[model samples]
Each structure stands twice: as structure tokens, then as C-alpha cells.
Target: MTLAAPTPTVPLNGDFWHTPLYTRTVDDGPAVNDALHALVLDRTRTAPTSTVGVRNADKTSSDLLRWEHPAIDHLRGWITDAAWALNDHVGAGRTPSGQDAEMIAEAWAVVYRPDGIHQLHSHHDAAWSGVYYVSTGHMQEGTGLLQFVDPRPSAAAREPDRTPLYTIRPEPGLLVAFPAWLRHWVTPYQGDAERVVVAFNVGFSRS
Candidate 1:
């Protein structure tokens, strides 16, 4: 048989090491908002004397409702969805079973009044963390925006044109979830109406 020449091939270039974020909206948003608004402002629920940054200015309940609260239950389901979405996005084909079940360690409500801000911090001792906006209030530019800092130190140097930070303006009934280790903060609120949010932390457990 006659010999034949091999054709040349080219290599493909693409992005790598991208972070995953999961966002969702509740189906019964209006009902959930009503329930959360009332629960966050419930006078009987004790607001702890928190020493965390700017927490004194914002209203917060120390109560971690694992069950019994309808809003919390709804949020629990949504967060679980976020976890599974993460499993699909990051672990697809990498592992046989993907991710395991997640355990809700704590859940609480936060109300940000004018000038309220949560200092830059990361959730410790949890695998996943998320926040649900019960009421975003009248949000304007730079008013109580949720911002996440890039966890990769080399990202900024690698992509100088791209900003190393990401921001999300909270909307009613909106939920945002991410890895617990990512550092994030809320910019000081400038609106007259109070901004309400429910936050939770989740960890994985073996069956």
C-alpha cells in the first residue's frame, strides 16, 4: 500500500478554574415574603448583643430555626437545590456520586436599616452558605449591595481588565448561594426602607 501524510491538528484554548454561583427565586414569592417580613420583625424573637461588624446597627435574631418556621423550611429546600446545582456544575463526571446531603447548621434573619453594613467576612465551619432576600427595599446604586471578593489571589494579576469583585443587588424572594469560604459583605444601605434578608449555613454529613 502507498504511504499517506498525516494532517496537522490545532490545540483549543479556553478558561479554567472558574467559580460557581447558584441563584434561584421562590415560586410563591409573595407568600414567602409576607411570612419572612413578619418573622424578622417579631418582637418576641430576641436580637442578640452581637459584636460582629455593624451588626449593632442592623436588626438580627439569634434564633437558628431548624424547623417549625414555614419560611425557614422553604429556604432550606431552596438551599438544598443550590447545593445539588453546585454538585452538578463543579463535580460533573469528576466523582461517581457527586455531592452528599447537606445539614443545616443555623438559620437566621437580618434587617438592614439605613447605614447598616455587614463587614467583609466568611462563614466558618460550614460547607455552604446563602442569603435569601425577603425584602430588598428601594435599592439604589451602591445601597446595601451584596458583594463577593475573588478567592483566587492570582485571578487579579492574570486578568487585569476584569474586576476581582462581583456584586448582586438583592431583590425580593431572591436567593444567592456559594461556597462558605468565599469572603463577602454588604455595602452600607442608603434607602429609607429597611432591607430584610434571611441567611443560613449548611454542612455535609454522611448517611
Candidate 2:
């Protein structure tokens, strides 16, 4: 029998932001969520006392833990694959002539936000950043919407002809990827339930 031709792998940058909202309903998502909850809660108990600004509200985050847990390595792998796929789409001209792409993972948590919400900001040193929703209650309905602002100031200032901002509502198993420099924020949750999400940043290194 004649062998079939192999399907070629598509480049990542071709469709990087085509799907800004990437979601996966893995069977392991619930388990991962449970683990994240426990991790965040445990850390919160002994977390260093510090205050952080959440939009107009004041909130606190667990100390930034780089590779503190074993699970983080797994999460890093998942993020790596996803980031590679995204980079294939957005990485073409962004990288130098002969440098290999590099990606890094940084994880953090935000806790105790009765009416707290993060202000519009971008990851300065990262190439891409994402948030994975862990738990959101009914009262916190629509609490985890990630809003991305247009980068073009001139286009934004064009009055009625301005480009519309994009908003993405993430489910428990959902993951989103966007340019690290894109301004974004989370809306305040109205309900009493606390919203928890694991956020990460990925970037390329000069190889």
C-alpha cells in the first residue's frame, strides 16, 4: 500500500490571537481546581502581610511563589504547550533572526476581595499572560470576565469610529492568551463569594 502524505504542522504566529479565549474541559480540571483552592488557602493562612491595589479597592495576594509546588511544574508544561501554539502564530517577526523562542512561567494568587477588582494593566516583562479561574459563586456571576483594551491610542481616540474593546468570560476550565503588553482587568464581584484564579506569564529567551 502506498504511504499517505504527512500533514504539515502549521506555524504558531499565523493564528495566535485568532482565538483569544482558549478553553479546555479536561477531566482533570476539577481535580486541578481543588488542588489550586487548597494551595491558595494554605498559603493565605501564613502569607506575608502586605497590601495591594485592586483597581480602586485594596486587596492582598499570596506571596509570589516561583516553583514552590510540584503541581506548578505540570501547570507550566500545559502552559508551555499552549504558549508554543500561540507563539507559532505571533512569533514570526517578533523574534530575532536566529534566536530560539523562550517561555517562562510565573504563578500568583489574589485573595479576600469583597468588592475588589484589579485595574487595567499589562505584564511588562512577559510576552504572554493568562488566568485560570478556580472558583466563582453565583453571587460572583460574571466576575471573571477578562477585558482587553485596544493598543492603538489613535484608533481608540477616534470617537464613534473607535475600535471596540474585547471582553472574555472564562469558565472553570477556560484559559486565555494575549500579548503581555495588552491592558486588561477584572471587574469586581458583587457576590460574597471570593473569586480565585491562577495567573501566569510566559516569554521568550534569547537562545
Candidate 3:
């Protein structure tokens, strides 16, 4: 397999210490999405819902991306490289050797039908976790948005709008990764179509 090049990562917040949010938008949106649609649909046939999050949606195990498919392979590689780029960006200098880098990667897929929602949770054992949007679905306001909570228990509370809770609207091909411990959840999806997402995590190889 050819080694995939790393895409430029954008820092959502300048203050890396406060709440680091890294994002990258892949260019191969059409092909990857087409492939993902079939891959997810086929997997759900046998897997059904794994009962992970608090939602009325189709969820698979963390090993869903392990299958041998072009798009799945591309994502697996893309995310691994992205994690390395993030490490280098943070000055950790951890193995940024492209495809040759050592890392523990796991990913799962979720298909949220209308009114599907997931509860708040965090990837407790991962270094960096991300949510990749394959299909944003036809959503209205405040639907299918990824919401992240402030880790600080008490900083400063603002009225009118919840200052502690930040949100990112879903976009196809968008890959947003953040600290593993940042607790987050998705708002109930009220879309007419399916909202497809791939949730992934990466950590140093424990060799």
C-alpha cells in the first residue's frame, strides 16, 4: 500500500493547554463517502447495534475500520498520520514518521437516524480522540452537533448562552480530534436522512 500524505491540521484554539482542538478536512470527500456508505451499511447488517452510547442508532464495535476496504484503509492511515502531526505540533516530537510510526489506533462507525442521540462520554484510555463526519444528514438547527464540555468544574458561568459548552457543526470530510479526556456528546439528530460518523482514538504503541 502507498503511504498517504498528511493533511494540514488547523488548531481551533490557540491556547493548547486550555482545551486543545485539532481539525483537518480531507479532500477526497466524494470517493471516501461513497465507499463509507456501503461499508457502514454492510457492517450494520451483521453487527446491529452494539449498545455503546445512549442513542437509538446503529453502532459498531471499535474494530469496524479494521476491515479491508479502500476507504476504511484510507481513514485508518489518515487518522494515524494526523495524530503524529498533532504530536509534533504540540512539541511532543513523538514518532512522526508517516506510515511507519508506531501507534495504537481504533475506530468505530455510527449511523444516527432521526431523533438519535448519544450520551456524554470520553475516551478515557486514549491520547487523542476524534469524530469524522461522513454524512451530516439533512439537519435543522441544534441537531447532530458535536458538543464538548469544559473540563474545568467552575471557571466563569455566562447567561443567555452556555459558555462552558462549545459545539462544532458537522461537515462531510471534517476530522476533528481533541484530548481524550474531554467529555463530549452529540445533540439529538432530527435529520430526515442518516447521520454517519466515524469515532476514532489513537495512542502510543505499547511495545
Q: Please give each candidate's TM-score.
A: 0.78, 0.74, 0.85
RMSD of 2: 7.1
State the displacement of the C-alpha of residue 196, model 2, in Å, after optimal TM-score superposition: 0.9
Better of 1 and 3 by lDDT: 3
Model 2, position 104, has a per-residue lDDT of 47
Ranked by TM-score from best down, the candidates are 3, 1, 2
Where model 1 places Cα greater than 4 Å from the true spot, the runs are 1-17, 43-51, 59-63, 92-102
Per-residue lDDT over 100-139 for candidate 2, one digit per residue giving the tens place of the 0 to 100 score: 4444456676653566678778887777777766665443
Each prediction's whole-model lDDT (CA): 0.67, 0.58, 0.77
Clashes of each: 0, 8, 0
- Candidate 2, 186: how far from true, in Å? 0.7
Summarize candidate 3's per-residue lDDT along 1-207 as a digit string, tens digits: 222335553344334327667777888777988899788878888765676775778788788666888888778766866676666567643455534445577888999888899899999777889988888787888788898987877555534354778888888898888888899999999887888899888876656
Query: Which of the two, 1 or 3, has more TM-score?
Result: 3
